[model samples]
Target: MATSRDQTLSIVYSSTATRPLNDADLSALLAISRRNNARAEVTGMLLYRGGRFLQV
Candidate 1:
């Protein structure tokens, strides 16, 4: 069994993309999660409202 490097990523997106995220985007996000977890990183959530990004 392969160990999971990427724990998880929870996102609440706003102003949906012209094209919703596909497989590639999902893979990339997973990669980020792994890298973050490895370094004891704090993964932040970005909120887009009125074209502004709010980090929470």
Candidate 2:
């Protein structure tokens, strides 16, 4: 009985960082992202490598 608008959705995003992020920077970014996503009731995974980011 679900319409398109009522269905769960998935997204994939990729980006390149202008500058490399250090451990502390990555940690901080993750903390903030987790907090924001939690507040929005959103869940996904993040991957970073060689100045690139992938979110799903």
Candidate 3:
């Protein structure tokens, strides 16, 4: 994978109001990450392909 200056790193949960990730989505996905702290983590390579998904 590659990194970019404008690209961002993220860590989201199903109940994350800020991350906007769903529990169903997490269940069928592949992920690798490191711990930032309790109830907070960091994620990488979250590819957002074309879709009707609204992330805000």
Candidate 4:
């Protein structure tokens, strides 16, 4: 897809957490993230692997 100069392109960024999160922490994070994302019209997925998080 092509975008006009006046329009900004949407990009996907991912990051890994510095440490592992417990169940409670993860739940709280998801809850807050969902709320914020919904309000901002943001959509993405999160992956937990080997004590780290990959969010995009």
| Candidate number achieving the greatest TM-score relative to the actual structure | 2
Off by over 4 Å in 1: 1-19, 41-56
Worst 10 residues of 4 by lDDT: 5-14
Better of 2 and 3 by TM-score: 2
Give model 2's clash tally: 0
- Pairs in clash, predicted candidate 4: none
C-alpha TM-score for every candidate: 0.37, 0.86, 0.19, 0.64
Candidate 1 lDDT tens digits, 4-49: 5556656554455445566686578668866886697666665444
Better of 2 and 3 by lDDT: 2
Give a tens-digit lDDT track for model 4, residues 6-38.
455466555677777788988998899999999
Give Cα distance to truth, residue 17, candidate 1, Å: 8.2
Q: Which candidate leads the pack in lDDT?
A: 2
Query: Whole-model lDDT for model 1 versus the true structure?
Result: 0.59
Model 1 Cα RMSD, 1 decimal:
10.5
How far is 34's C-alpha from truth in model 2 (Å)?
0.6
lDDT-best of 1 and 4:
4
Q: lDDT for model 3, please.
A: 0.40
lDDT (Cα, tens digit) per residue for candidate 2, span 6-55 = 77889999999999899999999999999999998788999999999999
